[model samples]
Target chain A: MYDFSADIADCAQAVEAALDAYLVPDRLSGPGPAAIRIIDAMRHGSLKGGKRLRPLLVRQAAAVFGVAPGQALTAGLAVEAIHCYSLIHDDLPAMDDDDLRRGRPTVHKAFDEATAILAGDALLTHAFALLADPACHPDPSVRIGLVTELALGSGVGGMVGGQMRDIEGEAGGFSGNDIAIMQAMKTGALIRASVRMGALLGKADPEALAALTLYAEAAGRAFQLADDILDVVATPEAMGKATGKDAAMGKQTRVSQLGLDGARAELDATIAEAIAALTPFGPPAEALRATARFFATRQS
Target chain B: MYDFSADIADCAQAVEAALDAYLVPDRLSGPGPAAIRIIDAMRHGSLKGGKRLRPLLVRQAAAVFGVAPGQALTAGLAVEAIHCYSLIHDDLPAMDDDDLRRGRPTVHKAFDEATAILAGDALLTHAFALLADPACHPDPSVRIGLVTELALGSGVGGMVGGQMRDIEGEAGGFSGNDIAIMQAMKTGALIRASVRMGALLGKADPEALAALTLYAEAAGRAFQLADDILDVVATPEAMGKATGKDAAMGKQTRVSQLGLDGARAELDATIAEAIAALTPFGPPAEALRATARFFATRQS
Candidate 1:
């Protein structure tokens, strides 16, 4: 079995370092403190401790194709930055109104709302800049591929569109399919992008890419189902945020539409499907396989 | 002697077409209506008529290097999209608190604030996607250049940073230099990016690019100065948005710092310098020179 836990820790550390390196402007003539605060808030939102699953996914996917860890780390940072920005915006009073994230105050709670908003915007913008940097990839076409994929994953057609649907679902009217689609967009798109970007960076063969895409789709749904299940079963302290928010806000989720047992069954099937998608790659995809199993069983 | 008026109208129509072509997904399987509303809000904010001056600048600058209008237009739409998204976010109640934009209800007023925010986010994301698109430029490097330039121009280090300064400036006590820096970032960066993108798209020589850079800087300053002057002298009816916001908010502006006459003199001299930067290009820059002259004299 692949030591995914160690791999995740290593990937997280590298991504954090990459984020710090790229985010803190190396130029001596930086803007004043007021401007610096925005950067601070961005750092605060993005660098806060989390599972770093997205970047881990990127690195693992890249590993399957013999890509360098350092190069994969940079692309991973781009996806994580996008993910962090989305989290920041999602925590806004105009949205989820969450006060906590990852056992700390949400960005809006830690900083003021306006600063949080600006910080989120800045982070989102910086992700593209980071991907375009030569450090991310030698070939310009590779960089463009990463960027366009990310934009589709994070923009209106993907994450943002999913977010709007999420907000609309707060009134609790979504059917099972709608919930799946919303979850895919809001959370799954970036996760899917994470895997696909890594594969792209490694210049994976088309067949491998196709298999990975399938794996990502199944894995993404399993990840969301796991999250929904955690929301129902985990404690607020354990989860590092409010528990039962899905039920409280009447937000339709897999656990809500499907009973907890039903959701668990779906998660099992999805995880199985995710692993099956990787069957063509054999032992090289052990890390990714472990990841799907981890997501399905993860409590926090 | 170029009839810039006709050129401006032509540029606007062409950009509108490009934006429509790129933005409205021709695929019949578009997102559902709720997701479509977010797209609608984005289109509402971006597509509604304006001078399209930024795109016009991109087109004119591209013309300087014999770049195709279609390619330049794509890059121009990218910049215009960024500008529109900025305006939408700026008009939010948490930000500028304006209710009118282009003489129509702001996005937040027409749609809810959450929708407005998502729309702005989507638009910003889309701008990068447009630039990364192979259709924007044949060379991947050119697309990467455009993406990176647009990111820096629109992101925290540029426009967003400038906006923070703007918000901070509202409490008053800004030096003239501070105001200049803020304006350069807030409004000037994107304008400069527009000209630079067009030139880059056309593969202008380094010398020509350097000259255009100088011209862009001078013209950018002149553009902001003209805007400050308009804020003081123009009416809301004429300006389309609320006038005198700078003065009313106690925000520092060129006109506020320099007084009307001093600001006007600065504008005239800046316009002269902007035109002079194109001296190396001779009559080929007539359109650009006319643009500077127009900014100096336009009432709105």
Candidate 2:
């Protein structure tokens, strides 16, 4: 009976507005104005369009602890910036080489490759700076904790490390378990970080934090599994980026490891597990439960 | 009486030792092991060679306020990591496109572009994580301040902005003033940040901090001017990387705006101004004064 579309849409709108403010092309970090070209590329890379799934996850996870949407948006914005920056780098010629992202030209294509690279680097730096800003958390200690979580989630043993592993896998290939590790690091880490960061922002106690962490881990797997299924079934037009490109690259994914039907079955089980992890909070976690369901059936 | 060469050597040795400890290939940020390929690439890019000039700057500047080299070393490592990561990205084929760094093949050339990109990303992220560590500063507030300084210094309006401007300069051409701004943003920002971060770690009073900022700005310009001179005059063998690269690519620098002799005179004046900024601290700031002179005269 729960409708998540409206809630997700509202969260996305708020996140995008905050991101727009953060992406000011002329904002000064020094005496001279910021490079308009790089800032534009950052805006282009981040502001255009996407599901804003990560920010929504942050909001929903925080809502479970009675945190208001306004209170969680800063952390949401920080996580979203990291996501956008990663996509920009991933689409570069040296990496995934995709020209399209969110159905528009990637940063490198919209600007120059050099601008795109600088934009990615700046956005990555900006994410940490945003976390340090008092608006993210009044307490410096809590802000530092958020910084640590986001850095590790997207950094070497997490997203970037996963990408490296997947790249290595491209050469040496991946086993079934390798696929899981790769997926966890590449995507799951950031997703998990988004949820955990939200709980941290709410000052969730250890028991609540543990419950949320478990929920996040399961939900991360569900989201990734659903993505693999979508990759196999969705079209570029529907997904807003090159679909089937991963498969075309012979990238071994969970879908490749467990056949398509098997992956879909796993996704359903994963979402159910994700929902079950929230059982301790019952109706207080309905938003997250609804989010888990939405992940499986999303068209884009 | 101030023979800086030996002091410089000792600082470099200590920094390299700490960097070696920090650059472990298997340090985990998550459940999965870090990608060995990316970690190896990080070590290759960061550990192989260089002056460790930035860290030494950090040490000397911190020492002005009686901060021990040991107290400043963690910050030294963080700033150096930023410097190294920038070098890795700057050398990418889509950017400066050099195949060499520190007398060795550049990261992209050695490992592949993908690994180089990931290594740079991870290192940049790791920098913030390092700043938040207890060893960096016992006070979370000061650590947060460090993160903000480093981020802004290397971010959109600073180093990355400068690089983007330089790239744009490639297509549009640069005026004399434009070259100065580019130099300030590209190389100047991070150098300035290194000095200020050192001062912050030492808890310099506002008046002392202002003096250090002025000194840092002058030193940054002197260092950039010297680097411009070296690019024109130094050999690839001596510099340990591609020399004459900016010129060959028609990249504009201060040396381009002011001819070689003019730039040499400016460098001397700049170093003098740097020294003048430290007059308030007198003997306490002698190390920083020595550092300013060293910047103007370094061969590589």
Off by more than 4 A, model 1 = A27-34, B25-34
Worst 10 residues of 1 chain B by lDDT: B25-34
lDDT per model vs. reference:
0.83, 0.87
Best by DockQ: 2
A142-220 in candidate 1: lDDT tens per residue?
9999998898888775788889888777755786578778878887888889999999998998999999999998999
lDDT of 1 at B214: 84
Residue-wise C-alpha lDDT for candidate 1, range B90-115, written one tens digit per residue: 88887888999989999999988888
Clashing pairs in 2: none
Native-referenced DockQ of model 1: 0.52
Candidate whose TM-score is highest: 2
- List model 2 lDDT by residue over B119-194, tens digit each: 9998999998888888988889989988988999999889989989888888899875888888888898988889
Residue pairs with colliding backbones in model 1 are none
Interface RMSD of each: 3.6, 1.3
